[model samples]
Target: MTVLKKLPIVSAVFRKVWLQIAVLLVILIGNILLDLMPAQKEDIHGYTLYKRWAAFLGIFAVTWILVRVVSVLRASSVMGSRLAPNISALLFTSLRILIFVLGSLIALDSIGISITPLLASLGVGSIAVGLALQDTLSNLFSGFYLYVDRPIAAGDWVRLENGMEGQVGRIGWRSTHLLSSENTVIIPNSKLSNSSVLNFNLPFPTASFNLVFSVSYQADLDRVEDTVRAAAESALRDKSDLSAGTAPIIRFTKFNETSVELTLILKARSFPDQSELRHEVIKRIRKAFRQEENLGLDPQRIFRLVSNQSDLV
Candidate 1:
């Protein structure tokens, strides 16, 4: 039954592939025929006009085939698996334009048109244009590197070293779009490439949340650990955002003059889930502490004793 339902999609894909192959074959045959045609006696710029026209046609046909082949390869999983879809499409487009330009230049040169002056002028103009658009080009190349290196991708939750964190909306030519909690942040690709990025979605969707708090030194250590563990377990069981496979961990990290600092490490399904999971865990732990005997004092408050000197004065 499932096979029958998917048959139409498979057949459609096969049909499209066959059509592309037929077009490519036609282009090749046309190029072959153009090569076989006789050159006329009429000359343009010391070259046979018929030969020039035929060469131009042949170049166009070959360029068309190259573009078509690349487009087909890019559309298949073979290329798409290695590169992001957007990046792959961009590369294919640039490849097509490059092939077309080179072919056109070759055809023009074949017709006895001197390309030396044109090449020199293009070189000078390109340098000037490149200088004017230095920043833009930097971003463009950075964006290309980001797509190739793949430090982060669309829909991945990432945090920059500067404390900006969000889910990536898109990776553009000049900038990367991030959909943060309050607004969208447009970060230049060059800056992103230079900065340190923490991708929470990489390797896996599960993320760990660390919650630090201090307990009074007077409190029982074993009881505190048990209470915190129970609270975390309750949070995991009651909240849908928390990961059920990994158990909550409690660690005694530091001992201050007044209190013992502890950390509660919990697992969430994703970065966004951390907030809710932390909230629920903190609430549960606070409630548990309040209900327990002799464990609800503020850990930050310090007590001081001063001797009275008024009698001596």
Candidate 2:
């Protein structure tokens, strides 16, 4: 019974292997036939037109097979899965184009065409084009760097030094797409390369959140601290989004004229959980302050009377 169940799986595997072998054999046989075929007429360079055509076809077949092999390698996990699908496809397409262009030049040379002058002209023309599209090339190169270095990947919450914070949607040749709030922001890759980016999703998803509050200056500092700490503990008790492993920290930051400034630091599971966690913590603290008589947090105001300028003169 087990053999019957595994029979289809084995057959499918065998069929896939056979198909790949058959494709390779076909490409090999085609190239062999092209080499053996006789030339019809000779060109000015002593090479035949038929041979040139055959060479072009052979080059194309070889490039196709190489591309297929690369795809197979990617599928087999030979090339690590760090690259996104779109980036991988783009790289492979670029490789195919480069191979085709080089092959075409060779085929043309095999005919009556001189490649020396063509190569020289292409070099000069490429320099002129490069100067004209300097910014574009910069972005393209920066995009390539981003992909290779992988400081930030798709779906990561990132904040740029310029204060553009969002979730990365896609990384393209020219720009990166970011989803910020309700809008989609397109930032040039060059800008991204130059700017400092903070990736919150990397290393770990846990993020530290700091909340500052002030209590009445008349309240006892130790009592205030203990009450706030108890409130924070109660807030984080049942919340799964708050990291329970790290204990909440409380510190008296400053002494104001009417209030004492206190800072509370805690950990949230991720960036998205920060807002809700903060809200819950604040609500709990506010309730605790109202219920406890010694934990008053109302600000006090003192007024001073000033004489008019004419009276001073």
Candidate 3:
């Protein structure tokens, strides 16, 4: 059709939603009124074929309206944190497909179409498609689970069970992108979903973790506590990268083979946000302990610390 001829048809279908509703209403109302007019079947095919078609058209219109509402919600819900906006988008699209399928089936059935053959063909086709794309579909559904369970999100620092640790770049339909210090890691959603992931940036950004250090056996316990606590408090107050949590506290936990172990609770703004912060805190504490000769390490520098409780930290 030429532009001029298409204008009327386009306006009727693509105008505001209320116009579509009005059109559907007119079709339904006119069909009802026609049925009541008591025309003989021999007079017009309008009594059978056309009437069924009109009812089918009405059903399809309502289906379109419902899918439109879902589309609007999907667009407006983009700002939901951690729920992966694209995942919501996929969800709405799936819902729209489902509505279209059901509406088409209902409309066809209303017009005396047999659905048995259609259903059998669909079942066979779906099985073939599923078998061919097993891995792809597995990843897709796993992405859906990630959206619902919310194990991680963009910008989170996560360590996967397979030993890939990084900031999440994005969670895509087929895979998740993670940017580490070394490289960007792309994980298939299926593996990520099944494996354990350690999220370092949850509940609070600046959460506390234990830092352990060893001191000489002869060090004064009382003075040691005061010195350590003073160092921790000073580091937290003066450092911008540290302390979004409780004030630092020191605890004399155990006696090791050669030295006394003390645990200091330290906070960070975010996981791996700064290696410099750890270095800075240790440097400050070491400088402070230099004045207190008794708090020095047995044979080496005083600040022999472990990070967040790995072996050497």
Candidate 4:
């Protein structure tokens, strides 16, 4: 189906699973034939070398098959899980190396080569290396857990327990990158795994905010609510993507010095949409109130824009 498969040599190798089985059977039979064939004293050394070569080839075949299986699993399982491509690749490579290493050791043992000393040294070295790279190993394992658990993902806004808040950018083997306030923040995976995180884009990304505005005491409460509701409803109808599929909530609060306070609770599909949604709703409502001068919006009072980051509901 691909250009690589269209090649003469490549196509032959991938022709059929039975073809690979046939090659494996040939390798096994060749080893058995080596033992069955009659040999003189002068040819014994050559036969020993041939047997070692055959053993190596057997190991190579097994490793090759295992690596291909790993590749298939990586493509289907890892990629399908929506894991970071580089992390999946790293895991695939690690599995391949483990297979090849075990295969090579088995091949050596088969040829009467002792691997005990090598394994012993490797064990001691691994302990030392593990101790030295303690933090790195912790981050690596934490990263693996983070990827599998999927608590955070790219483009999701997350607030960490330690006052760190941002949108997730990229997750790596060592660190989770965050984009905050136009800056890239690199936090270690270990910290993210252990910390309490609030994801704004999960458990339903729809977020609500309250708009507190006051009108002159002379304004009719019933007329004010009706006018503002119509305006906000118009905004929601026009920008469906920003709407949270909920109706606007209009309620009155307390009395002020010369005006009564009213609150307009509105919902946005996501946190980022709050700005545009609020903008559209406020623009429509203000215009509606202006057209209906009887609504008494208190021209002396001005609307001051406040940051919506803390307007989480």
Better by TM-score, candidate 2 or 1:
1
- Tens digits of per-residue lDDT for model 4 on 98-179? 9988988888888888999989998999999999999999999999998889998888988988888888999999999999
Q: What are the per-model numbers of colliding residue pairs?
A: 0, 0, 1, 0
**TM-score versus the correct structure, for each prediction:** 0.73, 0.69, 0.81, 0.75
Which runs of model 1 end up more than 4 angstroms from their true locations? 1-56, 74-85, 294-313
Cα RMSDs, all models: 9.3, 9.6, 6.3, 5.3
lDDT of residue 293 for candidate 2: 43
lDDT of each: 0.74, 0.71, 0.74, 0.79
Q: Top TM-score: which candidate number? A: 3
| Residues 1-313, model 2: lDDT tens digits | 5673566544433444555556556656765765565765242343455455555555555555555555455454435376666667777667767776776777677666789998999899989999999999999889999998989888888899988888999999889999999899999999999999988877776777787776665667787788779988888886865653577998877877776677788887777676777788877777776677443453232111111111100
lDDT of 2: 0.71
Among all windows of ten consecutive residues in candidate 4, which has the lowest summed lDDT?
301-310
Q: Lowest summed-lDDT stretch of 10 residues in model 2?
A: 304-313
1-313 in candidate 3: lDDT tens per residue?
Answer: 4663656433333443676698798997887777677558447655777778888888888888777766655544333342456786677789999999988998999899998899999999999999999999999999988877888988898788778888999999999999999899899999999999988777655545667788767667777678778877777777765556457768888888877888876666777744555566677677677766554443254345544452111
Better of 2 and 3 by lDDT: 3
- TM-score sort, best first: 3, 4, 1, 2
Error of 3 at 291 (Å): 2.2
* Candidate 1 lDDT, 1-313, residue by residue in tens: 4673576444434444555556556656765765565665242243356556656666666666666666667776767788766667778889878887777778678778888888899899989999999999999899999987989989999999999989999998889999999999999999999999989887887887677776666767787888889988988898865563688888888887777777777778887877787778777887777666454543233211111111100
